[model samples]
Target: MTDLTEHEVLVRPRAAPEAPAGRTTGWWAMVLFISTEAATFAAILASDFYLRFSAKGSWPPTSEKEPDLVLPTTATVIILVSCLPMLLGSLAAARGSRAGGLLGTLGAFAGGVAFLVLQIVDWLSEWPDSTVSKDAYGSLFYAITGLHAAHVLIGVGMLAFLLVSLAVRRAAARPRGPVSLVAMYWYFMGVVAVAVYVTVYLSATLWATR
Candidate 1:
């Protein structure tokens, strides 16, 4: 005869799962920050268009010339290309590979520095005669591109800080959030850089030359 036991259970009792920590707040904060930045950039771009179309005859005036495209085009490519390494670094951090993460960040920083150097050279060569104080064209051109360049600088700084943190192994405990935020900011800056290139260089040159 089999004895029926009230305490007989096929499986052991398991502890209750821990509640997920609320992570949405950080993500929403980042989104809000980017949105505000985007709006400010939109206003600046709008002002650029308004000034461009409102000007008499050709934009850039006859005396001022369209900026040389070769260098600026190269810089745009470099800046956008850096997004790849930035992505890699973020992924590596999330995976908890300190070496891979550091290497990726360094690669991105190199690319960013190269882009900035090219920009400085291009500005010196192309805009030697053009000054922001000279006219609306110069002012808008400098304002838009300068703002974008500053964003790149900030992105690079973020990566540098991430690198330092990784070097110290501080992110081992929880690396996802900080790295993810930096990746988002980098991507936003890259997209905005493309827009700036199109507005300040491409459209302006095409319209001014026509």
Candidate 2:
């Protein structure tokens, strides 16, 4: 082979950059997790409706009171509003704004705590009238709403971790992946909260009226 000239040196092609963790396995795993959770919620809600329609008496079985819309509606509003900061923070993190990410994470965490407090208050208010062992209506209501509360708790924990991480890590060292993942999870929680409100409170009331 002829020797390459100085002006025509062979150059190795540069390898493509690795994909961000947010767009890789982690992303798909989050999506799958959300899907499974959504299915679980759907099944439970469907059961609630089925039992409501099939029962020979009133939807709440007369002994149980219909869920009050006030507290849960407030909680739902908080959850949905919390999603905004998470989205903004994730977007900021992706753009390399660590301060924005930190602030967003803090906002989300506060909202989650607020929601849990409201939920607990609502549960306490209903405790005298409804308990899991009382009846089917009570059992299903607690099961659905409690399960959703557990999810929000988990998401709050995740946001707390993210907040700590962002606070401790340098701006250059911050990872957008975790922020994006947490944001997505927060959004899911918001959606599920609304669904729970609609199914456990609104739908039951409407069905009773019909």
- CA-lDDT, candidates in order: 0.82, 0.89
lDDT (Cα, tens digit) per residue for candidate 2, span 1-71: 78867656547455799856545787899999999999999999899888988899888777887778899
Clashing pairs in 1: none
Regions more than 4 Å wrong, model 1: 1-22
Residue-level lDDT tens digits of model 1 in 117-175: 88788678756567788888888878888888888898889889987987798875677
User: In angstroms, how far off is 194's CA in candidate 1?
Assistant: 0.5
TM-score of 1: 0.86
Q: Which ten residues in a row have the lowest lDDT in candidate 1?
A: 3-12
Judging by TM-score against the true structure, name the best candidate.
2
